[model samples]
Target: MQLSRFTDYTLRVLFYVAMNNDRLSTLNEIADFYGISVEHLRKVVHALAKSGYLKTFRGKHGGIRLNRTPEDINVGAVVLQAEGAEPLIDCSGLDCTLSGVCNLQRALADAQRAFMQELNRHSLADMLDNTAMKQRLIGKAV
Candidate 1:
């Protein structure tokens, strides 16, 4: 299943913040690096903070940071939070005549579950294990 832009940005924000766990990271800095909108990241950050994945600070020296360690943050859990528990196919809203007879919904649901299971096998720390990627994302700072 394809993830929404919101989920994509959510992962981006987490990666940026986790890489810079030594200090707080500003929304503008992350947006500039990813060429994303600060306004959009603001919503993403707010949601992350509310969900306890990120901690935010205010005032002159304000920014964001991961509330928990990278190893403690499960990729599947993060994706689940950003994407929600919605089924892969929203058959409820569709008036499909084969709704009861079709096994497509079940198949899609199983696939979605398997996808999440695979993601659950890796943590944010596992993703960050690539030094080259870290260097590319945050230069030599990481």
Candidate 2:
């Protein structure tokens, strides 16, 4: 299953912040680095800050930073928070006759559970461990 652009951007923002944990990061810098729109990143950053994943500072020298340590941020938890608990497939609206008896929904549910369980095993720290990769992407000395 494909994740929404919102989820993707949320993860990207977290990764960038974790990589540049040495200092606060600005929306323009992050947006330019990833070649994404500042408007979209602004919304993602606002949501992240509201969710306590990030802390924002206002004014001329304002910027954003992670509120919690990288190790404390669970990848699975982030995905769940961004995507919510919505079903992969909404069978309620489907008019198929096998909706009641089909095992497809159950199988998909199980797979999704497994997917999240796997992600739960990793954290932002794990992602940040690839220092070279992070450096290349964010151009940070860290």
Candidate 3:
């Protein structure tokens, strides 16, 4: 299953912030680094701050920093928060007669649960543990 762009952006924002934990990062900087739109990043940043993943500062020298340590940020939890409680598939709209008899929904749900469980085993800090990879991606000498 493919994730929504919103969820994708949320994860990217988290990764970038986690990698630059040494200092506050600006939206423009991250936007330029990833070649993504600053406007879109603004929305993602706002949601992240509201969810307590980030602390946002206003005014001239304003920027954002992670509110919690990278080790405290769970990938699964973030995915859950970003995706909300929406079902992966809406079987109600289907015209198929096997909707009630089919076990596809159950199988999909189980797979989704397993996917989240695997992600839960890793944290943002674990993502940055690969120094060479982190440096290569974010251009930071972490």
lDDT of 2 at 55: 95
In model 2, which runs have C-alpha deviations exceeding 4 angstroms? 138-142
The true-versus-predicted C-alpha distance at residue 55 of model 2, in Å, is: 0.4
**What is the C-alpha lDDT profile of model 1 across 62-86, one tens digit per residue?**
9999999999999999999999988
Model 3 spans > 4 angstroms off:
93-95, 137-142
TM-score of each: 0.93, 0.93, 0.91
User: For model 2, how does the per-residue alpha-carbon lDDT over 1-142 read when each residue is reduced to its tens digit?
Assistant: 8988999999999998888777889999888888899999999999999999999999998899999999999999999999998878879887999978999888999999999999999999997888677668566422
lDDT of 1 at 111: 92
On lDDT, the stronger of 2 and 3 is: 2
lDDT, each prediction: 0.91, 0.89, 0.86
For model 2, give the 10-residue run with minimal summed lDDT.
133-142
Cα misplacement distance, residue 48 of candidate 1 (Å): 0.7
Instruction: Give me the overall lDDT of model 3.
Output: 0.86
